[model samples]
Target: MGILVFDDMKMLDVSGPAEVFSEAGRFGAEYRLTIVSVSGEPVRTSIGLRVPADAAAESAPPFDTVLVPGGDLLPGTPIDPDLTAAARRLAERAGRIASICTGAFILAAAGLLEEKRATTHWQHTTLLARSYPSLRVEPDAIYVKDGTTYTSAGVTAGIDLALALVEEDHGPDLTRDVARSLVVYMQRAGGQSQFSASLQGPAPRTPVLRLIQDMVQADPAADHSLDRLAERVRVSPRHLTRMFRSELDTTPMKYVELIRFDMAKALLDAGHSATEAATLSGFPSYESLRRTFARHLGVSPTRYRHRFTTTRPAVDATRPALPDVPGNR
Candidate 1:
């Protein structure tokens, strides 16, 4: 395994995957980890730690897997040309290449993601898509696998991607042991949506779509079928769908379901039973709700409730807000 490092990079992007591979080695996996930079110098990580490099990228041996980690400065700022050149060289000598978090920016900059389906940190997925029209960007995936290139969501998703790589190299049995040792799920419950603003996505750019969205949010249990919604909005069903797809990137029915799903989560958080929440959220029955939960979250409603329901204090009014960090978020 070869890890490419640079200044201002998210510390965990490199360390998290390295830790997973290190733990897998304890179970008799022979994985050699090598860290490199362009000029064979130590790189300063996001948290002010200087990580020593094992060798320079120009002469490092070919790797079975090459990891490109993201930095805070990689997204908004123009990429350093030298760094892109080095990444291209390293990728040329690797069997497979994986980009962690905003590292997808680097890969996309090098033309590696052209014509490939990929993803990046959720907050930057739009910019990625806009910048590279040839790549299919999946904003909701935890990680995406496209042939020999892989791209993942933000910081901790790197660990998830590394776990998947371990499973591919070794087997499910060894991967399971590594996951147990690290105290993380062998498989995460959901995509990037679960950790982000699940209740809030992009607001509609036009009033027509906004009105439709408001109608769904106002009464999730209303007749939100495409035809009915189109009737309510005084447009044809096909036109309504075009309006939704143009602005919201989803069909009308899926948007209605998303609204109901949010209501179901709120009801469950208020201690309502799953069956009641299901009914109240417009689902026909508990089984329907369970299936929806599994599709969106990879877990049952009861299990999702249990996993996130530990008692806690209310939001602290005087607490400081989080500072804005681009790729690190």
Candidate 2:
């Protein structure tokens, strides 16, 4: 595989996938990894680290796959003509193509993804779709495969995409080992929004907003209708709605649902069954919990538990138990 590198590109966008392939190679896969920059010169990465190129992109041999990883600056900035040209040139010679995060911008600018279904970081999916009107962008996807072209969400989702690629190349057995070696799940249960700020935003600024949020969280199963929330905070329903929109950027009932959703996820992560999780987290029924999971997470509650929770019984019974994570062990 050939990785196309450029200045200011995110370091992990290159390294994350590279490590997956590298680990697979260590386990007897036949991947020959190479990194090529536009001019074979060392380029600065997002964190001020310099990455040395193996060859110039224009002169590099065609590989089985070419990867275009994202950069923080690529989302809103102009696509560099030289970099885009190099990517276009490299992609033309490769058998298959993929992009990680906002690297889709470069691919789109190269006219490769004109009509392809693609995605980028959750924060920039709207901009990507609007800027490139021809591209069919799936904003909620962790990664999308439209024919041979693959695009993934921001940052760590690149690893997920890489694992998928490895699975396609080899099979589940080898790919699962690679994922285990890296200490990441082979696939995440949901879309990127579960890791985004829409549901997990900053603390409320005002006293009333804070107080109202506290009450909703304190009893997610309770009737947190606009009228009830307003009564608790001694405000009119309309005023409360406006306050929530201004501060939390969501409605009162939506906030209540999000709180319940969070609790349900926690319960599932702690080895509870979906049915038990729903009951403990205040959902009226397992069906309600499943609907909320499908809406926000793009996966069923049972699927989410198996993928994310180490304590839960995994569907892939061949695998041993893994640790739950805030960080690597």
Cα lDDT tens digits, model 1, 107-171, are 99998899887888878999999998999998877787776788888899888788877766776
Q: Rate the local accuracy (lDDT) of all candidates.
A: 0.79, 0.81
Best by TM-score: 2
lDDT score of model 1? 0.79
- Model 1 alpha-carbon drift over 4 Å, by segment: 189-284, 294-329
lDDT (tens digit, per residue) of candidate 2 on 1-329: 89999999999999999999999987777788899999999999999999999999889998778999999899878988989999899888777789999999999999889888888988899999999999999887778776668898988888888887776677777777888899887666424352633356887888998887687667767877788888888999999889888988888778778788888887876779999999887899999999998888666898787654221222334434332211100
Pairs clashing within candidate 1: none
Which residue pairs clash in candidate 2?
A: none
Q: Return the lDDT, model 2, position 319.
A: 37
